[model samples]
Target: MLQTESEINMFNASLKGKLENLSLSSFRDLTILNLSNNALHGTIPSHIGSLTKLGILDLSMNQFFGALPLLLGNLKKLTTIYIYEIGIAGTIPQVIGYLKNLLDLVLSNNFLTSSISLTIGNLTKLTSLYIHKNNISSSIPQEMELGNLKNLIDLHVSSNLLTGSIPPTIGNLTKLTSLYIHRNSISGSIPQEMGHLTNLIDLAMSYNLLSGSIPSTLGNLTKLTTLHMGENKVSSFILQELVSSNLQTSLIPPTIGNLTKLTSLYIHRNNISGSIPHEMGHLKNLT
Candidate 1:
């Protein structure tokens, strides 16, 4: 068996032809492929789908164009796929659902559009995902589609045009550490379900349209370090209005004192009322 399937790193080679002669049948045992920072141009070959043994594929900082190859989903063992700033346009293929073993998926700073598909929920093993800074417009899809990514850790999908509410099911990502969905058009109350992310460290959802009282559930995140939830309508004005109107929801549950690890906290621009509990002094780590 050809042992060529071990590691093929051609990062920043300035190679041209845009994958024209990039054939892989001979390298059936291939595992890692890094072609980042190159001059490669043209459509990704469909034959790429046949590389079932590939684990890491990095094609970032290239000039590749056209829609992402659907055949990419064929690589079932893929652990990481970085396609950042590749000039590739088109919606993320639903076939990516096949990568049950994928760990990281980065496709940021491109011209790509469309919303994340529900099929992404199948990547239950995903850890780090960075698909922000793209034109992927529209609200994030419902939790019924991607609430199963329980192993997710760092999710940075900021700087997009994403609308809609933060899905409560996101609490299912109990292992999350850094969650950055800021600078979007997301509206509505911050999901109390978010409190379940006990492992979370950094939570940045600022500059959005989120409302309602900050749920004390967040205090449950004992590991939290950075919390940015500003520029929303969650102030006491809205809170009092919501309470007087008896529209929906409750108040901060004093349980917030549990986040002893928190260092940076940004809760301005909201309608949050009530006096700061003395328990807040227990946060000796607060900065």
Candidate 2:
């Protein structure tokens, strides 16, 4: 229970029972509230919206139900929100764009449905956005405003029902180091613009309808250590222009030999033909 004039600005506990009785609203000065991994049941109390000073709110791994309240926009200072795996259903609210200070949004493994809100483009400061393993059934935004998140370093939207080809504008996220969009219904060829992500370390796009040959631009990602593009419609002649080796007629381009840092490469379950290039010997780090 909150005491009068309590100086506890941050609250984290496994307490059970409805949140309304906690009178969280009275703790006007609260900055962080975490009630995750508890037996707490009931809708997230609207009083949480009153905690304007809050910077982080975590209510994941509980029994909470119902949609996220639109009042959440009132928490203008919030930077991080973790509400995954609590069984919350409904589309992410459009008002969420109001949280200009938000830097991380983790809503994976939920029942969230429908398309992603275009308003998300307003959050230019976001660095990590994880919405994978959900029921979201929409094609990746074709306008590709997500490229506006210049600070984005991690983006995961795998294990959903997404479709459509990757937008060439995705190259605009030059700061990305990890990108995962596997296990979806996404089709079409890999965008040459993908070569722009030179900082990528992990790229997974398997178990989808992706077709066409692997873009040689991927060779530009010298920092990449993990690349999984299996179970797709990709053909032979992968990465033909990836290196200066200029070796042609090989199924797996010798240019692949240039990725010395590659540790895990999963290019199975495809229509690939010809012999595995001997150049693979260069990947001494492969495990």
Candidate 3:
């Protein structure tokens, strides 16, 4: 029986209360469940794993607590799962790697800790993954592979306790437009392979223990708009190359005058030395 529009709205709104005692076997044609921003509390019902046809499940901004249900992996067709900003605690369930069709997975701003699972490499179709602002520590999963995510665009894993060098293999994500891996304990040199990301528009790798000269190859990022590598151990020469490149800021390298299109530059708080280039006077926007 087809319900009226108002009736359907009422049903969805009260569905949580009704599901308090719901058994997974009773649900039918319920392919999309979005209980976000609701006051729903308690662990997700284990029976939810039976919803094999669910495409999107959002339970964010709630008081739900406990480890993510491993049973959700049974939803093979799931595309997006947002469980961030909730009281969800514990390690991410390794079973998440089973969501073969997942495109966007956000579990940030939670109580999740421990190293990311290597099984994440299995989600080859993912485009956006946000697991930042958590208590996760240790070197980035060296085994974490993303070579198959050719369509990936944004990756944010900042503000955590991550350590070790960033893998050069990350440059394999040629389709990436934005990459943020800052405010961590990451050390080592910025991979020269990063220049391969010609499509990158914004890149941030600050407040870490990273040392070495910035990759000269980074000058190849003609599409770049913002580049933040400050607070790391980088050389002034690389900063000059960034200034001559596509950056759009004034406080950057004096060579930045070459980027006639830059409108806002911030290069303060570093070992950068040398007088401001007089050529900067040529940029009317810099005046």
Candidates' C-alpha lDDT: 0.77, 0.79, 0.72
Tens digit of per-residue lDDT, candidate 2, span 1-287:
23234233223455688766778888898777777777787887777889889887888888777788898999999999888888887888988888989999998888888988878888888998999988888888765467777788999999988988888888989999999998999999889999999999888887888877668788798888887776676653767233111112346767888888888765543445588789989989988
For candidate 3, what is the lDDT?
0.72
Q: Which ten residues in a row have the lowest lDDT in candidate 2?
A: 240-249
List clashing residue pairs in candidate 3: 243-256, 248-262, 249-264, 249-265, 250-265
Which RMSD values do the candidates have, in order?
Answer: 4.8, 4.1, 4.8
Higher-lDDT candidate among 1 and 3?
1
Q: What would the per-residue lDDT of candidate 3 be over residues 66-130, giving only the tens digit for each residue?
A: 88878888899889988888778788788898898999999989988888877788888899989
Residue pairs with colliding backbones in model 1 are 5-29, 5-30, 234-270, 234-271, 235-270, 235-271, 236-271
The full ranking of all candidates by lDDT, starting with the best, is: 2, 1, 3
Better of 1 and 3 by TM-score: 1
Of 1 and 2, the candidate ranking higher by TM-score: 2
State, as a TM-score between 0 and 1, how close model 2 is to the true structure: 0.89
| Model 2 spans > 4 angstroms off | 1-12, 240-250, 269-276
Candidate 1 off by > 4 Å: 1-5, 236-258, 267-283
Q: Write the number of the candidate with greater TM-score, choosing between 2 and 3.
A: 2
- Tens digits of per-residue lDDT, candidate 1, 230-278, equal 6655543222011222223334435556767767654433445566667
